[model samples]
Structure formats: C-alpha cells, structure tokens
Target: MKLKLVLVEPEGMINFGFILRLSKNFEVDELAVVRPKFQVDHEEVLRFAAQGKDYIEKVKVYESYEEALEGTKVCTSAKVSGTDTVRDFVLPWELKEYVGEPEVLSLVFGRESVGLTREELSKCDLLLHIPASKNYPVLNLSHAVAITLYEVWKQYRLERGNLPQKPSEKDLEVFMRVAGELAERFVGDEVKRERILIGVKRLISKASKSELRSLLYLLSRCSSFLKG
Candidate 1:
C-alpha cells in the first residue's frame, strides 16, 4: 500500500514542519499541501522539520483538493465530528477493515481551527475519527496526522507479517466476474441478484490471494454441478 499524506489549507508553519517529520517517520510515499497559508520554504518550516527539511522541500502543493487527489485510488478524510449525511465513520484503529492494499491511498487532514467542511468531507471516500475525550475531542494538526499514520503503519506491518502474498487487482476482478455469474444463475430477480453480487464482491475483497483461489475452485465445482 502506497500512503500519501495530505494537509488541506494548513496555516501554521510549525505544525506543517512537524507533519513533514511525521510523514518521513511513517514512510509516507508523498506529502501534499492544498492552498497552504504559509510558504513551503518558510524558515520556521525548515527549522522545525530539521532533518525532515528535505521532505518539506519536496512537498507537493496543489490549488484544490481534487488536484491533490489526482491519482489516489482511496481517499480518507479526518474529521472531529460526523455529519448527518456522511455518517460512515471509521475509527482510526479500524481503518484496515475499510482500506485494502490499494496502489495509492490518500489520508487527508483538514485545517487547524475547524476540521474538514461538510463539502470537503463529502468528497472523501471514507471518514476517519480518532477516539478522544468528549471535553477535548479536537487534536492538534500534527498530532492527529501522527496518530492516523501510526495506525496505518501498524496495519501495513501486520499485512506484511501475516500475508506475504495478497490478491492482485486482476485476481479480484476475475473473482468478481465469476461471483456475479454465479449470483445471476441462482437469483432470477434483478434487484436481488444485484444485491447478492455486491455482497459477494465485498466478501471476496477481504480475502487473501490463497483464500480467493480456494473459493474460486469451490465455486467452479459447484457451477459444474449446477449445470450438470
């Protein structure tokens, strides 16, 4: 999984510097800033970033969030509170369940004072919140980034340790096709068939390559029997 850290409209140079250091610590593939209030090469930024100054220099600056997320396959926005319309909240620890090994995954942090706006949060594919005290629910910009990155790094390490070989995109595509065909054969109703196919896709998405291979073999045998 390629991890990209994005800070939207960041105002504090010191915080930006700390975030750059955090990005380096977590081995983030790229660091992006959208419409930053301070200059990328500000003296304080370089001073705080210290050894991570190199990362700050290479930070990608964008005019808009859309441009910042150009190549990102999965995007998650950090928010203090959930919106009524966008209520699919995934805690920082549970991020692995929502996120697979995508080629590029973008984790977006909003401004300092107020987190992501409703409109900005709406653009993100998932919403992630850290569990904190209700009295002081909000966290400092760099601190929030640090926590989120740590959880992501933990998940990456777990995946590397347990599952050496994960399923590729092609493997997932083939499984989805076969699963859809099987669902169609079993269900005559169009709506029911679509729902079943979608459920099957989600199930296969969480499987490892070896597990998916076993499932495909079983499905093939069952398909033959049904045809016979």
Candidate 2:
C-alpha cells in the first residue's frame, strides 16, 4: 500500500515543515502541495522539517485538487464537520474499511483556516474526521496530518500482510468505462443507467485487486455477448 499525503494551500511554513517530517516518518511515497501560500523552501519550513528536507524537496505542486489526485485510486479528505445529509463520513480509524488495497491511497488535508470546500470533498472518495471535542473539533494542519497518517499506517500494518498488489487508478477507470457502456447498451432508461453505473462504481470502490479483475472479466464477457 503506497500512501500519498496531499496538503491544499497551506499558509504556515511551520505547519508545512512539520507535515514534511510527518510524511517521512510515516513512510509516505509522495508529498503533494496544491497552490501553497508560502515558499516551500523558506527558512522556517526547513527549520521545522529538520531531517525531512529530502521529502520536502521532492514535493509535487499542483494547481487544483483534481490534478493532485490524477492517479490516486482512493482519496480521503479530512473534514471536521460536514452536512448532516452526508452519511458517508467515517472516523479516521474506520478508513481502512472504505478503502481496499489500491496502488495509491491519497490522504488530503485542507488549508489551515477554512479546510476543504464542499466541492473538493465531493471529489474525494471518502471523508475522514478525527474525533475531538465539539467545542473545538478542528485541529492544526500538521496535527491532523500526523493523526491521520498514524491511523493509516496502523491499518496498513494490520491489513496489508501478504496482500497482493492492488489495482491502479487506470484499472478502475477502465472498469468504469466498460460498465458505463454496458449500462447504456442494456438499460434503456437514462435514470436507470445512471443508477446502475453508480452502483457499479460503489461496488468497485470497495473491491480488492483480485475482485476487480474478476469483475472486469465478467463485464468483458457480458459486453462481448451484447455486441454479438
């Protein structure tokens, strides 16, 4: 399981530096920053990062959240609060259940002030929140990153023992495209087609690499029959 840490528009150099260190400590495969507010190589950032400057030096910068997660199979946005209607929010410890083995698992931490926007959250596959006091649920940027990374690390150690390499984002995309085509061909109603596609995506989202391969095979066989 490869873990990627993404920070969106972080303003404080100290926080950025600390997160750099945390990423290294947690053995993150990649560190990405989206439209950072301060220079990444600022003295303060270096000072806080200490020995983790190597990770900071290789930090990938992106203009948008979507670009940052280009090849990520599973992405979770850190949020302190969300709409009551959105029931998919999961606690940090429960994240492993929502995310099966994937080539790249992205953990997105929002800016220090406003956090992730609803639009950004919608793009993420899941929402993760650290349990805290209601009076002050939001946590510092680096702290949140540390906690989330730690949980994921623990989960990785527990669940990834002897597991096969997971499917990549490209693999999932191919499956979705094939499923969409099948839905369009067999399901006459637009609404029904959309629903079937959504259901397929949800199932694929939780599927492991072998499970996805089996599903793709089944879909391919069915698609061939439909064409014939």
Winning candidate number (TM-score): 1
Q: TM-scores, in order shown?
A: 0.65, 0.64
Q: lDDT of each prediction vs. the true structure? A: 0.79, 0.80
* lDDT, candidate 2, 181-215, per-residue tens: 98888789999889888888888888888889999
Clashes of 2: 0
Native-vs-model 2 lDDT? 0.80
Worst lDDT run of 10 residues, candidate 1, spans 71-80
Clashes of each: 0, 0
Q: How close is candidate 2 to the true structure, as a TM-score?
A: 0.64
